[model samples]
Each structure stands twice: as structure tokens, then as C-alpha cells.
Target chain A: MPEPVEIGRLTFTEAEIRRFAGAFDPQGFHVDPEAARQSPFGGLVASGWHVVCAWMGAFVRAHPSAADSPVDHPSVIAPVGVGFGLQGLEWKAPVRAGDTLVFFTQVLEARASGSRPGWSVFHRRNSARREDGVEVMAFELRHMAPDPAPGRG
Target chain B: MPDFFYEDFVVGEVKAFGSHTITEEEIVTFAREFDPQPMHTDAAAGAKSVLGGLSASGWHSCAIMMRLICDGFLLRTAGMGSPGVTENSWLAPVRPGDVLTLRRTVLEARTSKSRPEMGLVTFKFELVKADKTVAVSQTCLIMIGRRNPGARLA
Candidate 1:
């Protein structure tokens, strides 16, 4: 098994939370501070989707190889691909404004795709924790990447 | 006082709602901030990718689905938020200009044993194209407050 990679951190600012939520979610606890204070959360909270998007941003930025390679010719170190799905996505704790989250990704398994030629499927566990070390979110992501070793497939 | 509560969700009920047309500008804007993958952000790069063309990030599609859900029924219900999604799948690429709609089904509804004030409803949500192609499907559990606590407890 490969070592887990620390994808880096993100600080969820109030403005960022509100802007992202306003454009996509618009839930009371996410978009409006006053309305959020009256909601069950009792204060503005970042949308779960926003947190996931932050993780993705961090992950992609951490691997600069993805940006260097063309789509048809993927980097061996960072074979870019699209996510097929996710499972067991859990928001264990609320992420409030100003909370800094540290993200990590661990590859669980990888196998050549049976359906798609020259493509490999990766199952990875992605997670985020607050600066205090409390786990806040977790999910298993499935994505397809170009196989580094083509003839083997 | 929400219009719908835990007691209102019946198992096996199905409903369809939403009509969102994705735009290339929005797709590029969203991708530049989040995914940033070539297939999602650059048209020329996307044409060279296995996806065939500029496609919205899968996360973008999920966000769109959330907006549809909020507008369709969640905003009117006594929603307590969701713990997590059991499963989610992107069955097809969500290209720009695609008219997406939502199809929701109540797979299960059960009162919480520990939290009597709320119930858990399992839902299967599908983001379908205008032509009936399902682009994304998700199964998740949501917590909804009961209209009256312990009113139906056996």
C-alpha cells in the first residue's frame, strides 16, 4: 500500500462560505448569517459540497503533474481522470467559518478496468480533519485513470 | 412550521421536479475553482479527452442536484440536514447546455429510535436529462423533524 498523501489545508472564510452557498446551495445555514444563526446550526456553516470542492481543489493543486500533461497523454505521476462515483460520504461534524481543515487521500486499491481499455480504476479514501485533529468529513472516491502500463491491460 | 415533516414522507413515493440548463460559462467558472481538470475547463483539451467534450465536473453536477432538491421539496420540509450519502454514481458526462431534471423516490422512512423528535428518510435521487438519460444517481439519508413527537410511536 502507498503512503497517504496530505493534500494540504483550507480555511473556510465567512465570505467564501456565503459566496459558494449562495451560488449553489442557498440553504439558510450556509448563505445568510442572520438566518443561519436562527437555524439549527446556530451559525453560518460551510456547505458540505463546498468542503468537498475544496478538497478536490487541494488535491488537484497538490499534483501539478495533472496540469502539465495533456488529456490524451496523461502524466505517469498524475494520470488525470474523471470521478465515476463516491460512497460512504459522511459529514461527521459541522464546518464553521474560520475553521481550517487538513485533507488527506489514501489509495485503497487499484485495478485495470474490465470495461474500458487502457484505463485503470482507483478506489481511494479521502478525508478532512479540523486543525484540532477532529475528523469532519470522509468518503471513498472512484475514478478512472489512464493505465501507466498499457500493454498489461 | 414547515409544510412537510417526517410523517409526510411515505415509502415508495416518487416525484419529479426541476429544469436547470447548464451553461458553458458556469461550467468553466466552477471547474476553474474546484476540479480544474482539462476536460472540465478547456474545450480543446476536452475534445482530446475520453469524455469527448467539455463536461461539468461531477461535483458540479452534485451541487446542481442539491439545488434542485432544496427547491423541489427540502426547503418546505422540516429538514434537519443529512448525515451522509450511502452511494452516488455519475452514470454519464454532464455536458454544457444539458437540461437536467430531478427524479426523487422515498426508499424508506423510519422514526429514529434515539431521537424521537426526528425520523430518517432514505431517498434515491436521480439527475436525468430531458431525453430520459440518467446522468447521476444518489442514495442518501436525510433527517426530518416529526410533526408531533411520539404521536405514532408503538
Candidate 2:
């Protein structure tokens, strides 16, 4: 099994949150820092979806565009799908602007597709929390990694 | 954006429309900007990975649904916004060459006593493929203009 990768810690700047919230969300807690401070979250909070995005990046170890990334590898490739089971997703604590959070990724499994011509699954659990050790939000994402021949030996 | 008064949107109503053509380009573009996972960004890597082949990002599907809403429903109506979505689920994978249509059913509509210009409207969103496959579905809550006589214009 490939060693589980620890994507390490990253911080959320209020500006990043504002940028995402403005065009996509535009909600008071997401886009307006001053207003977010007064909300129950007690400060500017990263959008729940933003947290998921960061976690996905961490789980993969390298960015998709990295030179060594499989995406850049020779075999024909592409993702079939990504499923987020919201049943267990939790927004435990609000992630605030400037708060550093580390991401932990555990590779649950890797298997060759039995049904289709090119199919496979890379199951990963992505978790993130604050530098102060507070769990904020997280979710498990399952990504489809399709390859030419069955290669999950 | 005319306020979509409570009286305007009736429950059990279904609105169908969209311009989302599931292009590998649009899919990759969205996944790169919003998701950027290995499977989403690289086609070759995805072939080697477990999901076997290329799949569309779930968020990409949802975002496209959002854009369709803006074009068909939201822009023509005054909308406040939804508190959030609950029980959101993506039932199937969407891929390139897929064409999707949004079918929205007005589940419920009610005047908010405290908010004079708006009423809450709940909808069920379904993304159907060209082959009549239901690829994704979810529930959404939106703030819309109300037509109630007692409702004030926002």
C-alpha cells in the first residue's frame, strides 16, 4: 500500500474566502468580513465548500498539474466521478481567516475496475482542523481514476 | 429581477431548462478552479487511478445547476438567497459528451412573516442526461419575491 500522505498545514486568508464568496456564494458570512465577525461563527469563516477543496488538494499529495503527477504520466487518464457522502460531513467549528489548518489524508483503498473497460477507484478520507487543534469541517471524497488496462496489482 | 411573489410559484410546479453541455473542457476548467483533484485535472492519471477513466466532478454539476438557475429562474425573479442545502446528494457521475437538463419542482412556498418582500421556496433539483438517465438530484431552498397582497416589494 502506498504510504498515507500528510498534505501538511495551510492557512486561510480572509481575502481568499471573500473572493470565493463574492462570485459564488456572496453570502454575508462568506463575503463580508465585518458582518461575519458578528455572526455566530465569531469571525470570518471559510465556506464549507472551500474547506472541501483544500482537503481534496491535500489528499492527492501533489497538485494535478505537478510534473510528477499521474495526470502528467504516460498512460491514458481521466477521472470518472467524485462522490461526497454528505451524511457524515460535519461543520464542527468555523474556520476563521488567518487560522492555520493542517490536512490529513488516508488512502482507504485502491482497486481495479471489474466491470468497465477502464475504471478504478481511489478512495480517500480528507480531514482538516485549525492550528489550535479545533476540528472545523471535513468530508470523504471518492474519485474515479480510469486507466488503460487494469493496473491495480 | 422581478420579485417572484409567493403566489407566482406554485407547489408541484416543474421548470425544465439548461445550457450545460458536459464538455471535458468545461469539466476540467471547473474542477481545476474549484476542485482540481488528480482525477479531475489529469486524464492520463485518472486512467491509472481507481475510479477507472474520467468522471466529472460533483461540484461541477452543482455549479452548472446554479448557473442554469441564474439564467432561467433567479434573474427574472427577486431572490434573497437560501440559508443552505440539506440532504444534498449526487446520485450518478456526469462525464464528457453528456447533455443535462434541469428539472425543478416547487416543493413548498410560504410567506415569511418577518420578511415582507420575500417568501421561502423549496425546490427539488434533478439533472437528467440525454439518454433519460437521472445523473444527479438534490433539494434547494431559495428566497423569492412574493405576490401576496400583504407582501411588500423589496
Candidate 3:
């Protein structure tokens, strides 16, 4: 197992949250301030999907491995990899607008696929916490990473 | 139409949701901002990669699915909120010019043990192409308000 990666912090504004929700989520508690205040959450909260997107943005910024090259194509940036699936995703807390969160990801397991010789499967967990350190969301993500080393095939 | 309450969902019934046409420009734009992988952002680069051609980010597919769900049902339903996804899979590549539709199936429905005012419904969603290819599949749990909050328990 490799070291855990701390993807940097992110903050969502009311305008940004509203824009994303208006286009994607559109729940009253996510898009309308007055309606949100009357809703159960009592405030404009970011969509769980929006929180995941922000975490992806943070992941892209922190990982230098985007520049890593495969043995065959030393000049090409390694592919971003393909997702296999996600499991056990839990939204533990609501994220209101103006909340700043720090995100982190860790590779839990990795092994070359026995059926597909040139591909490696990675199981990873991603999570986010508020600036005060309360966990807001967590999920497991699985992806197929192309083998960088040669000779297995 | 009135909003749906706890008893509205029927298990074993299939509900069809949305229709959206995929576009190359939107795919690239979304990728540049969120995913940014060569396979998703650059057409030529993607053709050269194992994915074979430009493809929409799986997250983008999820976003589209959310829009469909809201427009199809959630907007008018007595929707409380959701905990999160139980699982999701990208079954096939989503390419430009593919007209996508979503279908939902009610797998389970039950009143919440503690929160009697709301009920939990588990749904299986499949985002399908015009040719009937399933591009994405997911299982999600949602909380819906009960029409009669205390009637069943009482």
C-alpha cells in the first residue's frame, strides 16, 4: 500500500453551490435560500454530488502522478484511468454554502487483474471534512489503472 | 399532480425517467473542469489511448442522471433527502451523439424504523443508450415523506 494522499482544501460559495444545484441537483434546499431555510436542513446545503465534484477537483490538483508515464508511452501522460464502481458511500453531514472542506484519499488495495493481463484494479477510499475536522462524506471508489510495467503480457 | 409519499412507490415496477442527447462540446467542457483526463478531454488523445476515443466522465453521467431523476420524479415528490449512493457502475462508454434515457426500478420500500414520518426506498437506475446499451447503473437510497406520518404506527 502507498501513502495516503491529502488532496487540498476547497470552499464552495453560495453562488457556486446554487449554480451546480440548479443545473444538476435542483432540490429546494440546494437552490433557493428562503425555501432552504424552511426545509429540514435549515440552510442552503451543497448537493452530495457537488461535494464529490469538489473532491475530484482537489484530487486533480494534489496528485503529481498525472505526469507519470507508462513504459511504452513515456511521453504521454498516464491516462486518468477508468472507474469500475463505487460502494459504501455515506453522507455523514450536510455541507452548507461557505463551508470550507479538506479532502483526502487512500489506496486500500491493488492487484493486477487475473482476467485482464495488462490492467490493474485499485480500491480506494475518499473522504472530506470541514475546516473544524468534522467528517462530511466518505465513499469507496474502484478504478482500473493500466499497468505501467512491461513483461506480464 | 401531488407529491409522492411513502406508500406511492411500488416494488417490482419499472419507471422510465429521462432523455438527453450527449454532445462532444459539453463532454469536453465538463472534463476540463472536473475530470481532465486525456480520454475524456481530448478526442485525438483519447483515440490513441486504450479507451479508443473521447468519452464522457462517469461523474458527468451521474450528474446527468441526477437531472433526469429530479425532472422525472423528485421535484414533485415529498422528497426529504438522501443518505448517499449504495453503489454505482459505469457499464459502457458514453459517447457524443448518444441519446440517453434512464430507467428506475423500485427494489425495496419500507417505513423508517426511527423516523416514522419518512420512508426509505431503494431504487435501481440504469442509464441506457438509444440502442439499448446500458451506459451506467446505480443503486440509491432515498427518503420520502409519509402521507400519514403516524397512521401506520398508530
Candidate 4:
């Protein structure tokens, strides 16, 4: 079993939550603090997508080799390639503004891709917990990465 | 207060929504903050990558799909929230300038055994391009409030 790697921590501010939600979600509970108080969530909450994106942001930034590489550099290899899909995504708890979340990813399986030459597939379990230790979100992500073996496709 | 309630969704019902156009600026901006791979952030690097040209990150496509869902009927529905997504697939790269639409189908609906006030609705959501190609698809269960929780079946 591969050990879990910490992605990094993130604090969800009201402004950032509102900004992201305004663009992609626009739900009252996410974008409007006052309106949210009148709803079931009881306060301004981050969109579920925002929380997922935060995990991605932290994961990309934490990659040792991919970090600090110029965006235009041709030789810059990303830590992971395009994702095939995700499964069993869960939002267990509400991520309200001012909450800080710690993220982690653990590799569940890895193998050569049968269909995509020169690429390998990785199945990983990604999760996040609030500062209070409540697990806020989790999902199984499948992505492809180029095989590192020399002379491989 | 909303037009749609748990009782409103009929299994196998299909609905279409959205006509949002993906833009290069939005794709780059979203990627710069989240995914940030070369193919998603830089046009030149994208041209050199396997994705062929500048493309929206898969997560961005999901976000866009969420927006379409909200605009479609979620906002006017008694949508409590989603427990999770059972599956999400990125079928094709979403390129800039591609107009996307959402095709939503209700797969199943059942009243919650634990919470009679709410019901669980399973849906298959597809984000389709103008050419009818599905770029992304997701299957998930959402909790919706029942319009009349105390009503009895005849």
C-alpha cells in the first residue's frame, strides 16, 4: 500500500468562496452570505466544486518536480496527466467560510494502460478534512501518466 | 418555494439545458488557479501536448456543468444537496469557443427511508457540445425535499 501524501492545507475565505461560486455555481448558499443564513446550510458555504478545485490546486502546487515550472516551457512535465474520470465522490460535510481543510492523496493501484500506449493508469483516493477533523470530501480519481521507462512509446 | 420538489422528478424523464460557450480566457484563468498544466494554461504548450490545443481542465468542465444544472432546474428545486457522485467521465476535451449544453435524465427516484421529508433522485447528466458530442458525463444522487412530506399514497 502506498503511503498517503499530504497535498497541503487551505483556508476557505468568504471572498474566495463567493468568487468561485459566482462564476461556476451561483448558488445562494455559496455566493450570498445573508441569503445563505436563510437556507438549510445556515451560512455562507463553499461550492462543492470549489472544494474539489482547491484540492486540485494544492495537489498541483505540491508536486515537487512540477512546482515552479514556467507554464510555457515545453519540457515541463506535469506530475499527472489528464484524468479519465472520478468515482464515488462524496461531500460528507459542509465547507463553510473560515474553515481550513487539509488534503491528502493515496495511490490505490497503478498499471500500464492497455488502450493508451506509452501511458499508465493510476487509481487514487483523494480526501480532505476540516481543521476539526471532520472529513469534508472524498473521491476516487483515475488519471493517466506517461510511462517513465526509457524508449517506451 | 421552488417549482421542483422531490415528488416532481419522474424517473426516466429527460431535460436539456444551457448554451454556455467555453472561452479561452476563462479556461486559462480557471486552470491557472486550479489544474495549471501546460495544456490547460498556455496555448503554445497546449499545441505541443497530446490534447492538441488549448483545452479546459476536466474539473473546469465539471464546474461549468454544475452551473448549467443550477440554471436548468436546480435553483428552482428543493435541492437539499448531493451526497456524492457515483461516476464522472471526461469523454472529450472541451476546447475554447465550444458551445456546450446539458442533457439531464432522471434515472431513479425514491423517498428516503431515514428522512421521509426528503427523497433521493439519481440522474445522469451529460455535457454535450454543439455537434452533439458528449464532452463530459456524470451520474449522481441528489437529495430533494418532498413537496408534501405527510401526504399518503392512495
Superposition error at B49 for model 4 (Å)? 1.1
Name the regions of candidate 3 deviating beyond 4 angstroms.
A1-3, A65-78, A115-118, A147-153
TM-score of chain A of each: 0.85, 0.72, 0.83, 0.86
lDDT for position B151 in model 2:
48
Task: Estimate, for each residue in A31-63, the C-alpha lDDT of model 4 and write its tens digit.
Answer: 988889987789888989999999998887776
How close is every model to the real structure, measured as TM-score?
0.93, 0.60, 0.92, 0.93
Q: Candidate 3 - CAPRI tier?
A: medium
Candidate 2 at residue A15, lDDT?
Answer: 87
Q: Interface RMSD (Å), each candidate?
A: 2.5, 5.3, 2.2, 1.8
Order of candidate numbers by lDDT, starting with the best: 4, 1, 3, 2
User: Mind giving the per-residue lDDT tens digits that candidate 2 earns over A1-153?
Assistant: 555455767778988887765544555667777867664445677766567666654544443333433444323233233464333455566777888888876668767756644556666655777877677765455555545323422
- Candidates arranged by DockQ, highest first: 4, 3, 1, 2
Instruction: Tell me which residue pairs clash in candidate 3.
Output: none
Model 2 residue A60 lDDT?
A: 42
DockQ of each: 0.60, 0.21, 0.60, 0.67
Return the lDDT, model 4, position A152: 22
